[model samples]
Target: MIDIQYSAEVRAAKNDGTPIVALESTIITHGMPYPQNIEVAAQVEQDIRDAGAVPATIAVIDGRLRVGLEPDQLKDLGQAQGVAKISRADMAACIASGGTGATTVAATMIAAHFAGIEVFATGGIGGVHRGAETSFDISADLHELAQTPVTVVAAGAKAILDLAKTLEVLETLGVPVIAHGQDEFPAFWSAKSPFATPLRMDTAEQIAKAHATRRALGLPGGQLVANPIPLADQIPSEELDPIIASAQQDAEAHRITGKAVTPYLLQRIYERTEGRSLIANIALVRNNARLAAGIAKALKAQAG
Candidate 1:
């Protein structure tokens, strides 16, 4: 078995049987520049704690899988340069090669499962990118959710993705996409999208029960809780629609493909929105963290 390092807090939570929520580290290393990334990470962790669960931010450091990061480690990672943004395909290679890396949603799910964590919180998941018919770009996150039995809470797939296609692909994969408290599927920065949700769940307890029921039935996959961003923080989808289109055009014009596509589009959106996108991102992540914590607690209660 591969060795996993646990931060002192996580070690304590494990020993005490406290509910824990897993977090991805790419948001720290790849989401934004230093200091601010660390600050947002700290805030999200605190939100989980305030909502009555511990947070385990997963990443790979110097080839070792770290299930939870200490304060110093988080700070260093935020400042580190050229860290690999790893997913299912590259995570193992990063570890085996003794390289430091930040985990994406898929990689975080794998690590969370290895560490026996059942819930995760993130801003938004990558999904069917626009123009994927030609690019064949689909996120490994969708596939991970189809097999890994951890509950993931997010606003929804990133707004830049083709939301309808993302939902269709999830249905095909047999993954449950449960929209929290609404009939409409949420856009990443906006509370509602044009598409209706495949499933709607109102309470964390209901979501937790669904998760347990899936496990009881020997289901091989996990559930996605589409928690919407708070109304005050949202950037209306109507406003973002045109911005996204423009960004995509820029991407096509610049020939930004594959992994570069997301960051480039996000930067363009960020520039166009004058930083409102980042603010909304931070808000939604914290909101997801709170809800994920509640689900973790509910699951713990169900187990007992």
Candidate 2:
């Protein structure tokens, strides 16, 4: 049997058949500083609640996989240091060893599926890193999307990555990447990218229908709803391009590779953007949470 933990709020929601959105805890543990991490996480959860869905923030604590978190748990997690960044590779080991860890996009999708939640909200998905052609460094997130049966809502692949390559990998893996409310795929902090979305969806009902249709057809994977961040909150692609390039250059100069690359690049970008990147990240996550709630509601209603 698989071990799982549920918060009081999540347990109640399950009992009542309420719509719920699965949230990743890495944003709290690895994405930012404590107070801001907890604060932004709380705001995202509340945003989902206000949009008519319960938020289930997933993490692994003391050898058990937790599908939701209490307020105190969230705070403690934010303050915890050296938390393992759990993904497809290490999530099981983290749980079996009684280790506490934060869930990345891939781990969150796996946990969400285990919890029977159909939608997950996050700031962005990871993808092919720059120079991946030589480094072959691709994120497990693309593969998780290829197999997990939960819909993911995000601004898009992280701008620090090679977005075009990321989209190509997703396509080749038989994953559906649908841009929400636009033809162009989103570029994390930016609302627009040069590449067009592989698919476009305008409403929660339509997205829900697509998800259900895939399952009905005996498909094995889920959909990626590439929700663009709100226009007013976006940093714009033009403004972000040079920043991303400089960060990548810095990573290369520092010989950063593997897991350390993302954090290093993001931190560089953060400093270069004068802290505006974090602001945009918070805004986009809240937006994705709201859209994910709507999709969850539609999925529940459709099932009913």
User: Global lDDT of each model?
Assistant: 0.95, 0.94
lDDT of 1: 0.95
Q: Which tens-of-lDDT digit does each residue in 153-252 have in candidate 2?
A: 9999999889999999999999999999999999999999999988999999999999999999999988899999999998988988998998888887
Which model scores highest in lDDT?
Answer: 1
lDDT by residue for model 1 (36-58), tens: 99999999999999999999999
Clashes of each: 0, 1
- Residue 10 of model 1 has an lDDT of 96
